[model samples]
Target: MMKKRTILRFFILATLLLCSSSAWAQGHSYLKTAAGKSLQAELEFHRDPHQTFAVRGDNLVLAGDLPVNVNYDFDYSVLEGQTLTVDGEQQHGGRNLVSIVTSPGEVRVESGTMTINKVTKEGEKAFLEGTYELTLEEGKTLSGEFKLHTQFRDYNLSSLGWVFMLASIAGVWLLAIFCYKKLLFDAE
Candidate 1:
């Protein structure tokens, strides 16, 4: 009886471990450079509620570190299948922006289309598959596919709201300590 129970426990533990590993797996993404070199990276979509005055709506941001010390940021409107131009000249604050920074040089997107193939929702998170074909400033083409995981965020608190909440908690804590001290003094 004891041996059977131990075997059952080990089987259950191994099954749980296998299931958890699959749940935490990251999606795959890659971009081929102008020189025919492919850069692989994991990209995830995060809904950013904080946008500047110029930007119209919330942006679906894809920012991640690439191979060979490269970092890329791609921001697009939440709506799928909407084609927009990549602003290479302007580095920051624009709709449908694509910027890539490398160790030695920076590669900006001159023109191209980023197509969203499909989006699959699993519970609160979603998986996005897309492809991008970009013409670089160096007159080279960069294209690849991306499978990104979605990150859900709550908009209940802004930056100011967070600060105010902390301040209120501190104030209440201080008030409680002060009252406790006064009560002790009066009793003495």
Candidate 2:
């Protein structure tokens, strides 16, 4: 009776371990864009399990094993002479990788060829262009747009222009009430 109980316990423990390992191996990797978009991809492990992996864009998440010596690139597009800010963050062990952001002027890559150009103000208008590259296992590229903006011949403003105009009218009304109470009315 004692021998049988020992054997049963051993078998149950072995099965649990196998199942756990299998589940961990099947986990997926994820990438998120700056515009609140997300994409997931499966990771393929080679030799080392805790190697460095690279991810680009915002809120990048990785599961399972990491990759070795990974490189990631990010690019952006904006109207010429426009001041833009770029940023990124990594989840899990993703910080071990190196990330680079290249704008249109700093380094220009076309048709797999790299060229350095003096990014300058082109007349009174310019078109923005950039790219992002990730060195990792083969997978699909996910993309999405951030906030929308209209480009005019001279200036650009947020898409909420109408909202701003309405707010201005409300402000004027409030100011008028304040002025009337202060100059023409008595406190009760």
Candidate 3:
């Protein structure tokens, strides 16, 4: 009995460790500032989980508010399998435009490259993993890595459609109740 109990405890501990590690790998970012300060935080989709990420035009936007507020946008890029080099200009063209906001302040990626290392796609969901090394103003450098998940569509219903569906369900329930009452009266 004691041996069985020990094995059970070992399995429980192993399960907990596996679950925690997977949860931690979901989405995370490690950013270094110009002044040598480092900020590490989780990048989560704050809006609805259904709307994990978005691709507006040629821009890939990941906005979240957690341990730190971050708005990481890679302009002129969509999906994975590409490396975007920052030309130091903020103009939206073939050049990759990007921005990183940390706790200290906003740091513009002046010169460097952000490489999307891997992209895992399962159905409509996609996981993006990448690393970036950029030069900030005054010869300061910043580099980090990021892994995030995004969905293709939210799949939300419109207000009018919801109203129509609810009305139809209510009408059917009312009809059923009325028919039951009429049947009882006829039996009487």
User: Which runs in model 1 stand beyond 4 Å of their true positions?
Assistant: 1-24, 27-78, 89-98, 101-106, 157-186
Model 2, residue 138: distance off in Å is 23
Task: List the lowest-lDDT window of 10 residues for candidate 3.
Answer: 50-59
Best by TM-score: 1
RMSD of 2: 21.1
| TM-score: the better of candidates 1 and 2 | 1
lDDT of each: 0.49, 0.34, 0.50
User: Against the hidden reference, what TM-scores do the models get?
Assistant: 0.47, 0.21, 0.39
Cα lDDT for residue 184, candidate 1: 85
Clashes of each: 0, 0, 0
Clashes of 3: 0
Ranking by lDDT: 3, 1, 2
By TM-score rank, best first, the candidates go: 1, 3, 2
Writing each residue's lDDT as its tens digit, candidate 1 over 103-178 gives: 1356554656556667665554555566767676678666666555543444557799989999999999999999
Model 2 C-alpha lDDT per residue in residues 51-77, reported as the tens digit of each score: 322222233322222212322111112
Question: For residues 102-149, what per-residue lDDT tens digits would candidate 3 score against the true structure?
Answer: 344655445666566776655655566777676776677766665555
